[model samples]
Target: MSNRGAGGLLGRRPPEEETGLPKDEIFDLMSNHRRRYTIHHCKQADGPVSLSDLAEQVAAWEKDKSISELGSAERKTVYTSLQQTHLPRLERAGIVTYENGEVELTNQTERLDIYLDIVPENSIPWGVYYLGLSFLSCLVVVGLWMDVLPTGAVPTLVYPTIIIAAFTVSAAYHALANRRYRFENLDEPL
Candidate 1:
């Protein structure tokens, strides 16, 4: 008889407790490649993307072909799947709003960024990289303090300055890479 509402037991937290969609819901939504493509297209678009155009791009990517090379059948198949399954689920999750044959992202779309980490292949994750850098810097400081490093003859201020410089440069590079890898900025005009 408890009126737990749509959230049910899986996520019955009050409004303030919700950051975005629940983690399970997000995983469910992103589990399908089609849905990921749909989100990518919606994010890249400056305005709502028409269903046909979105399907065309998605089909093209799926088939490894250009949009112009996609057959009507391929486009239709994707369009149907998106219209009947993927899009509606996204709409319900508040990740997207679908209406009038067009799709646009909702505020909830931003919440997925943490899950959709944009690390390039062979590149270390930013958090891990930063942690390693901190550890190394700590080790260097310890060495300097113990007079174990070759920098024993170096100025005391040089150690702190070098450590600060390393961090500053890493932060700047991370900022640039963050912009480059952000999904919304892909294929978008500057």
Candidate 2:
């Protein structure tokens, strides 16, 4: 039998594999500004935040950082870093919870702590998965063209259709999941 204890508020097993390291790792990873913003928003006592709020805060931060004039490229870099790098890792660690229209923290302290051990080295580039599907779909289509597979047994259009549908749905799900823990503004003193 697994080592996971029985179900209780905090005793329940994490949705993913458990690591032996202490939970401080989560906070350590949060040492960075982008990662810290995500954690503070989700785990903060105030409450959950919306994606629009997050986007707005990011925009405001960009403006505030300008000495005289703001660089669009710099602002874009921050935004991209938050959305592509920090948030995805936090989501994978299960520190943030996503739902209908808001993001909140999952109150599993033990699990949350355990998640700290596995710092997300990089955001999972979902676009790569879509691209892979596209390439595979093309290959399957080519096979059909060469008559490698029996005609009518498998529809020529089915592969690409499935790839498109799967990628679309998965991307949507990931977006929603990441958005769950987003806080509107983190510039305010916490």
Candidate 3:
């Protein structure tokens, strides 16, 4: 592992192989809501964005409104927060560079994305979902063993095979969805 930061009781910082982040720092930077929104907007933009534009977008996201529909207060609230707090935090973390009233993503910005995820309120985590699928697979296998489930037309292992295949496909789909927030692919279609 790369020792990019001084090691202590906390252990060596995580290597920068892909995420360009120490594992601990990623969480710290992502802890605030505004910073998360700042990085999200930076990734979504096609190029460097003015501070005012970024704040407007973030305010729009928070209000679930279009830019033109946003009240001055809404935009100003986000703008002040970003200018005085969030942008500086992100810059210090090397996730973005804000200068002269404009902000742009750095290579580290892409890595920051790994720390942010938006999940629906009603949804179980993917790991739990996969575990549930595995449990169902095992139950099917046991049902076959006990002959409680009819395996008359197909092989005894067929039901379990289908269940495992379903899990594999679902996991792959979710993996791709996780990458949907990546900076490099932001301009690409989902």
**Predicted model with the maximum TM-score:** 1
Provide C-alpha RMSD values for all models, in order.
Answer: 6.4, 16.1, 5.6
Best by lDDT: 1
Candidate with better lDDT, 1 vs 3: 1
What are the lDDT figures for the candidates, one per model?
0.83, 0.55, 0.76
Clash totals in order = 0, 2, 0
Identify the runs in model 2 with alpha carbons over 4 angstroms from their true place.
1-21, 43-47, 58-75, 98-102, 109-190
**Model 3 residue 98 lDDT score:** 89
Candidate 1, 187: how far from true, in Å?
4.4
Q: How many residue pairs of model 3 clash at the backbone?
A: 0
lDDT of 3 by residue, 111-131 (tens): 555455555458778889888
* TM-score-better candidate, 1 vs 2: 1
Between candidates 2 and 3, the one scoring higher on TM-score is: 3
Weakest 10 consecutive residues, lDDT, candidate 2? 181-190
Tell me model 3's lDDT, rounded to 2 decimals. 0.76
Write one digit per residue (lDDT tens) for candidate 2, span 4-102: 566424566434335322346555655665565555545554677764455445555545653235466655666577666766666666666644545
> Which pairs clash in the backbone of model 2?
103-180, 103-181
1 or 2: which has the higher lDDT?
1
Instruction: Please identify which of the two predictions, 1 or 3, would achieve the higher TM-score against the true structure.
Output: 1
Ranking by lDDT: 1, 3, 2
Of the two candidates 2 and 3, the one with more favorable lDDT, higher being better, is 3
